[model samples]
Target chain A: MKILAVDDEPLVLRLLDATLNGLGYHNTSFATTAAQALHLLESSKSPYSCILLDIRMPGMDGIELCQQIRRMPAYKTTPIIMLTSLAEKEYIDESFASGATDYMNKPVDATELAARLRVARLIQNEYQRSAHLEELNRAQIEGFQPMAPFDFAEPVQIDDVSRVVNSRAMENYLRQLDRLGLFKIGVIGFQIRHAGSLHAANAPEEFYGILADVAESISENTREVNALIAYLGKGSFAAVVPRASQIDRRDLEAGIAATLYEFELADLVDSTSDIKVSVGTQINGSVFGNTPDKMIDLAVRSAQGMTESKPKALAARIWSLAG
Target chain B: MINSQETAASHLAAALAEIRARFINDLIPLINEMEYQRVAMTDPALAPEAFSSLQHASHKISGMAGSVGFPELGDHAARLDVTFTKLLRAPYDHAGVQAALDPLEAFLSLMEDILDEVL
Candidate 1:
């Protein structure tokens, strides 16, 4: 399998090269700086099987580089292993936050490194294979009936993992919003981009972990607006963030984006970060007069517009420091 | 031929011995740098930079020592790293500095004991 190793230290790189070779991992590439790594990745004809990145690099540290790479559609879920001497808890957390699949301590053991590389590649490939099988199975089912939306007699507990209400519940909530009158309620939809692929290769635990983090984040960020968040199947999550005062669509969008990113890719793949948010407001006596399902469809349509562009479509407002 | 598993194990033993020899040789420059940091960390005037540098050295050791078959050494370094980090962030005062330095000095003493055995 092909691999890319990036580090600022020549000695470190040499040791890595030696270790990989001793372990029989020969199809390897090297980069001395994060810029070089980016340039190499951008220019490659075929994607590398996995990446071994050094966390402490000059001119764009590995964490920043990982973030940038995660934004790229091509390598979003490619296994990224941080090979570095920076073993601090915060550094490790930041690496994972930025999309590192695994973190290996420096002076990497050749035997261990080889085994990790083997496993990382195997898991990635296995995930893809299983995903395809699931898709095939899904398509072949004759007269398949969709599962019913979950029903809860009691309010979902604070500790319950499922954050988003099911499709039926969403419809019920939409009815409430409609009857409440225009400007009294609002709804925003978040579609987890590439949901199929996310569930394709990952365990149920991982899939649910992301759902839980998203639920927790939405609850935390919109506590002020008292947003009621619900999970709509097929990777779509929605929240109704009501505004007492006239709420700028941008304000709702900003808070959602920031909170989502805070818990976004800490464990999920890069594509998981491709989530898109859409806002539907009722203001100026203009009620969004639609059924719950249709309102969701409208929200999805708004979100669909952003998904076409990706990562950038993630947020409505952005400010960048000028080069 | 060194093709048998036993022979391979011997070969691995030999290679590991060579790696340890190199490790001991390379560790000096790291210790030398840490000494400079130790001076800064102890002196109230230079404590900030030295404290940071000491923690950096400890982090490096923490990351490296384990692969060299010295997990205890790595743990000691990691603990020291945390001490330095805590001291650096805590309110900088004489008593606070001393509290931080006590753990810092203990970690250093532990490192010295480990290094002496290695040497």
Candidate 2:
């Protein structure tokens, strides 16, 4: 895969060049400044598959550069990994917030770099598959009914949703936090009450619109706290927040319900929408036992285990009142 | 194929060694600038800028030194970087700053030792 690595240090760039070459990735380019990297990105004939960026630079630092790159239509979902020595929690938070796919601490180990590159390759392959499916969709639109590009159970990235990240990036952020001994975090999951029915009833675009609305509601509700939300397929979303932020399960559910109610009233959703969300109890990350993946799984399971009976009764009451 | 693989591995090793040697050579001037910054930190007016400069240099060293096989140096630089970052963030009088930077002497000595061994 074609790669672009941006770092101010000449030695680091040389080392990366040699390391990448040894690992059989010879089609790599280097830039010493964010400006230069932007120039290369704009002028290159072919799009780069992955990019490695340093967090600290003289002008227009890597976070800003990552944001700028995300603004470009072609690179919105490209795997931009922040490779730097700044292991501070703030930098990690900002890097992911600015649309970085992964963050790797410096003093690069070949084994670790190879593993990260492997993940990047997987992401790139997924993107390519999606692009191919989209082409198929366009071609079949005029002939037969177009197939949905994504499976109903697939966790597609929600674009243009503030504070919402792709599932992989969320996992990476959690893993990095775990590695850095920042275990004082909580995970909570939210699930649509009748997602299967909704998926069956609505068109693909409508279902996606529903998901985006849900994501925006969740993001708005959690705005007071530092939270990173990710949709984990099957109409479930997991959010990681600082443990200090006291999140009442009932309050979050109510907030989301109110927001969806507003969306329905404003015709932001279909007229028949009875969308409601149930929130799980917070799963706190402890120093000893829980892995990041395990935390996510347990939170999702918690949400899944919640009986939708109460939400259904409540929605019925709300509908009766509305009538 | 095995011979070719072996040749490629050896070539990479040689390239890494050359890069490490160049890194060590480049550190002499960096160490000199850091030492100058260390001296400059005694003045209250220059201390913040000096601390900022030291933090930047040490951060670079902390990141690169370990990758080139000098992990001890990397660890030391990382510690220094942390100290300088803390100093830069908080308002510190000259004496407090000097007290915090007491570890610099040993860190500089370590860099000099590495350079001497390399040269």
Candidate 3:
């Protein structure tokens, strides 16, 4: 596969070349500066399969190069890996923001580098295939018959929630995140005070509808926070915010609670126990015994604790607002 | 005669060995530079540049040292990077900076022995 390696450090470039060659990735090109890299990218006959780069450079660092490359129609779908020593969150965040697909900390291990390249290659191929299909015909994408809308029953779309994900899906996502050994995840659990009371609301759809309004409020306010909100059912919903270390869970909780509060969430859920956000900081697989059930149980317990702890918060606040 | 695969494995092992030694050798200068920067940080006038340099150096090590067979060094460097970053945000927190320096100082001392074995 054709790949480009960009770095200003001669030693680092040599190491990258040797490592990639050692892994049998021999058709690799080298450039010392972002300008040179851009020249090579523009001049190359075959579109590169992958690009590996360093963040810090003599002129126009890798991030800018990544952004410039992404802007190009030809390289839009190609995978870019930032192999750099600047492994701080700010640099990583900036790289991803500039449209980096994968980030590998350096000095990189040969095996790890090879594995990342393989993964990136697979992703790039998939992206290119999809892009090509769109080129063939816009109808290629829209031609499929849309799934029939639920006649009070269709499989839930776990992604964009007109309502938070259902109980089982939430648990599954939590389990998947934990199993991935991505420990810096935060979960903010919201316990609906009287889910049982919702039975009176015509059908389960109405209860879910109220939950959707609450979730929408959450999504709108915490848009910058960039978290996943899910419904764990049984009066519990959770927002799992990745990169928990960089984000202050308390501030996020307060922001969400404020939105829910100002919106007078009591009108939706009916019973007023101001959604006391139970923030879970440690999301390692080891935490909550590595099962979604335990995590859900803990969320339920937290919601129950909120009821006991702050019996009068929702009512008092709502009354004050009315008065 | 060894197979080509075995030869490649040893070659990789040898390359890694060189990197490990270079990594330890590199830490000495980086840690020395940071010591100088830390002293500069005591002077209110020089603190900002000193802290910035220290953070950059620590950030470099934190990003690569772990992969180069010095995971503890990476962890220590990461803490220093974080401490320097926090101090950068609040330069007047001399007491906080001093508290942060203790762990970094401990790690540098620990590294001297690791360097001996590695070198």
Candidate 4:
């Protein structure tokens, strides 16, 4: 795969070059500055399949560079991995907010870099396959059964919403926080009350549009607390917020309902006029024994009202027995 | 065929060793430049720019040193970078600058020792 790596330090670039070459990635280009990187990206004959960016640079740091690349139409869904040494929360938050697909801390381990690149390659291949399927569908080929590119339960990326990230990126953010021992986050799940009915009633595209609308409403409602929202498919969404932020469940539900109501009135939603979302109780990550997947699962169950009493009662019983 | 694979692996190892050696050689002058900035940081008039330059160098070293087989140097550089960043946020003072100098000097000495051994 064609790759581009941008860093101001030539030694780091050389090291990366050697490492990447050792990993059998030879069609790689290097740039010492963001401007130069942009030039290389634009002037190249074919778009680079994967991009590696450094967070700190003299002009236009990696976060800003990632944002700029995302604005380009060709790279909207391309894999952009941030390779940085800065482990500050602010940088990590900004990197994902700017549309980075993955992040890796530097001192470039060959094994880890290879793994990240493998994931990037997989993402790129999937994009290509979807694009091909989309083209075939658009062409209206004879006797063709149009297939839905994504499953109803797959976490589809909701684009064009501020502070909204893909599910994978959200998980990675949480994992990074966990690694840093700074995982003081609250996970909340939101589920559309009638998502299944809506999905069955409308066309796939229409259902997707409704999902995007719900995602936008969730994003707008949680904008005040700086929540990172992701649509974890089947009409469910998850939001990660700083645990210290006070989130009243009633207010959030009301706010989202009001926004969806406004969208229905404006004809922005076709069949989602009766749709309501259930807001889950915030699940705070404990100082110990809380993984990202477990927190997310608990939040989703809470939204679904599956674990309202059983788990809590069971935990209480266990604690009493231990006592 | 196995011989070819072994040859390729050996070639990669040699290339990586060369790059690591070159990185150490290049780091010496950069560390010297950081020392110059560290000294310049004591001057009130030059303190802001000096601090900025020093932090930039330390950040680079912290990011790159470990990849080139100097993990301890990278840790020291990271500590120095954090110290400079914290000092930059507060008001500029000689006491803060003086306190930062010990780590900077220690980092410089560490780099020197590593270079002496590596070279």
Candidate 5:
């Protein structure tokens, strides 16, 4: 990839140029001043793939140079990586806001720089590939079935663990499904008595804690299962687990219910009523097959039925098929 | 290097870009530990030791940054170090250090802006 390396320090500029040339990338240019860098870009007919800039420069600093480069039509979308030495948070935020593609610390490592450049290339490639695929998909979808805008009911599974719940006492249940070992499964919207209230109040801190405690209890009981669990907001949570799988639906539901029951929310329970939950599971899912964006959409949809807001008749239904 | 528009606006951006790289690598990892130190330092019994540790860290950062030509960051760090130092020297001025935190956070936010600009 073609790169324009800018740094006020001669030693740094030499090091960068040498590193890139040594790494088999020969198309490199060096500029000690921001004005010189701008002159080079303005004069060159060929566009650079990336710009390596240092913040401190003699006349026009790197930041001004970046802005000038961005304003010019030739280098608008070209990625710029800033090289800095200070480890202050304010500096990081400003760099990103100013339109830098990435930042690297001084005493720069050649390998890390190359890796970062490669990642940037991959992202750019993926973006181009996706844009092309999207056009194709738009046409293909028209041939298959009518498309509908996606909608979600609620978030599911605050904690990162699996559970089985069979207690008929609760209408909504939340549990995680991780049989495939590909992605995390989180089921949310389960409360024995106050599920509706918690859901309505937007799952207050007390309710969220109850949800986390429930997942923690299940994880502690099973000891065999481990996961990272956190509430996703509302009466829901997301649990990242080892895998996803299809299992005995009732057993899975009951295990979740059992784990939830161990949590002591005496105050919340007393203030309202018993808390119960309904569980949902994904029948056929693989992390590798489904991208994170698609998987999250599916998981959120899978947990929909566990909400009381669904038509009473629909809320009472169970998954006949493992889907 | 202080042009009203370029340095005030873009120069700061450049300066921030320089610090951004370090923030991601060094500061983020220490966040959890900083919180721990804050808790320990704010405690009634261990306040002195906590204040001293904070002062030491801030002072070291202030000195190091000053040597490297980041007078703005160095000045802020020195102010913070002094505020903490006050707490150590005079127990009654415990609240003095809290006011310095905003500037630090603001500095952090400035760095974040640079990152957004570049990345």
Candidate 6:
């Protein structure tokens, strides 16, 4: 695969070239500045398969270079990886905004770089294949008989409107959803327990306050949530947390449930009544693979399982489903 | 089928209207209050009135701006508020007031640009 390695440092350039070549990768090109990199990219006879760029450099940085590459028609679809010494949150965000496909820290390990490159190639190939299939699909549709309108019978499940309208805490919940959705780990479901009792209670304001606090606290700790943490009517709340590849599904489920229990949310509310929390988790093998929507559905099922179990100080149930 | 151009234009218009309404109703009032305090502070005889008004005006503007996600504006207003508060709390400094006002004006322009984007 043809790779363009751009860095201002000579040592970094030499190391990357040697490392990639040692790993049996051929056709590597080098550029010291953003201008040189762009010049070579625009003029190079051979199309580069992937580009690795350093973030900090003289006369236009990697982010600007990546933006420039994206603007060019030839390299619009090319995968670009930002190599940087600092993996700060702002840099990571800027890298993504500038259209970087992947990011790596400077002084990158050869093995990890090779693995990332392989993944990048795979992702690019998959995207190209999908684009080709889409074109074929359109062609076939044009040639064949007109199909019926897509089925509208399936009712669209609107997640609890409160989550969206509750802007005060929505950012935290939304961030969790984004993280989980990206990972495509599992399904998530939410139930709002004690709603009726809380509303009917003498101190309704205090009860709601407790509920909001608990939701905010849970949202803070949990990431990789596939589904909305909906306020299931009657004061129950739930969400599905995606488990990373290295994570043990059973342990992850238990750990999250335990964390929720440990959160001193009840203290936030001036409540005289005892606080009870119940959670249900399922190992969604099928939904765990990928696809954000499917993963969310699986998480919802797991959350559904929690409501069925008897309520305790902190009740949690586990359900296993085939992937 | 709805045309994407039409959809985008409609959404943009709706966003713009909402932004205009917010700026007029919410943001402008706060700015006027700040201006009032600025005027009041010009006379040393009304120093107490000016100090209280400035404190109220700047704090409210700063807080509101921050809540609505125009934090840079909020920060500028906040810095100005701090300078005003310092002037009142300890000793008065005209140079600090001037320094703070310059940035506040810059931030006001920034707020206008941000409103355009949101709209």
Candidates, DockQ: 0.21, 0.72, 0.28, 0.63, 0.03, 0.01
lDDT of 4 by residue, A85-111 (tens): 888878888898889888888888999
Residue pairs with clashing backbones, model 4 = none
TM-score of chain A of each: 0.46, 0.89, 0.51, 0.85, 0.42, 0.46
lDDT of each: 0.61, 0.85, 0.63, 0.81, 0.50, 0.53
lDDT tens digits, residue span A1-323, model 1: 88999987654565566566556566889999988999999999997879989876557999899888876666655788877765554565456546666767665777768767876777468535654323323432332433122212211112233233333334434453354343355556665556667666565445555556666666665666655566655556666554354555555555555666665553213534444344444222135455556656666556544523333443434322111
Q: Better model by lDDT, 4 or 5?
A: 4
Supply the global lDDT for candidate 6: 0.53
- Comparing 3 with 6 on TM-score, the higher-scoring candidate is 3
User: Model 2: per-residue lDDT, tens digit, A1-323?
Assistant: 99999999888999999889888898999999999999999999999999999988998999999999987767877899999988888899889878999999989998999999999999888878786445433534344454464676778778778889889899999999998999889999999877888888787767878899999999989988968999888899999989878998866776777678778722223334578788898999998889999999999889888865355555554455446
lDDT per residue as tens, model 3, A173-275? 4544454444455555565445555534435444445556567765654566565566554545666555444544444444545566666654324435443
Model 5 residue A139 CA deviation (Å) reads: 22
| TM-score: the better of candidates 1 and 6 | 1
On DockQ, the candidate that comes out on top is: 2
- For model 6 the local lDDT of residue B107 reads 53
A178 in model 6: Cα distance from truth in Å?
Answer: 13
Off by over 4 Å in 5: A127-323, B1-119
Q: Which portions of model 4 miss their true places by more than 4 Å?
A: A131-150, A265-272, A306-323, B93-95
The C-alpha TM-scores of every prediction are 0.53, 0.90, 0.58, 0.87, 0.34, 0.36
Residues B1-119 of candidate 3 have per-residue lDDT tens digits of 35866776677677767766666677789767877886788788898898889877777776667767778877787778778878888847768768866776786777777877866
True contacts kept of each: 0.26, 0.74, 0.31, 0.55, 0.00, 0.00
| Residue-wise C-alpha lDDT for candidate 2, range B68-109, written one tens digit per residue | 888999988888888898888888666667676668888899
lDDT of 6 at A122: 76
Q: After superposition, how far is residue A259 of candidate 4 from its true place, in Å?
A: 2.5
Per-residue error (Å), model 2, residue A79 = 1.4
**Ranking, DockQ, top scorer first:** 2, 4, 3, 1, 5, 6
DockQ of 3: 0.28
**lDDT tens string, model 6, A220-314?**
43433423343333444444433442434343433344444455543212334434343445434342453444444554455545542232322
Error of 3 at A71 (Å): 1.1
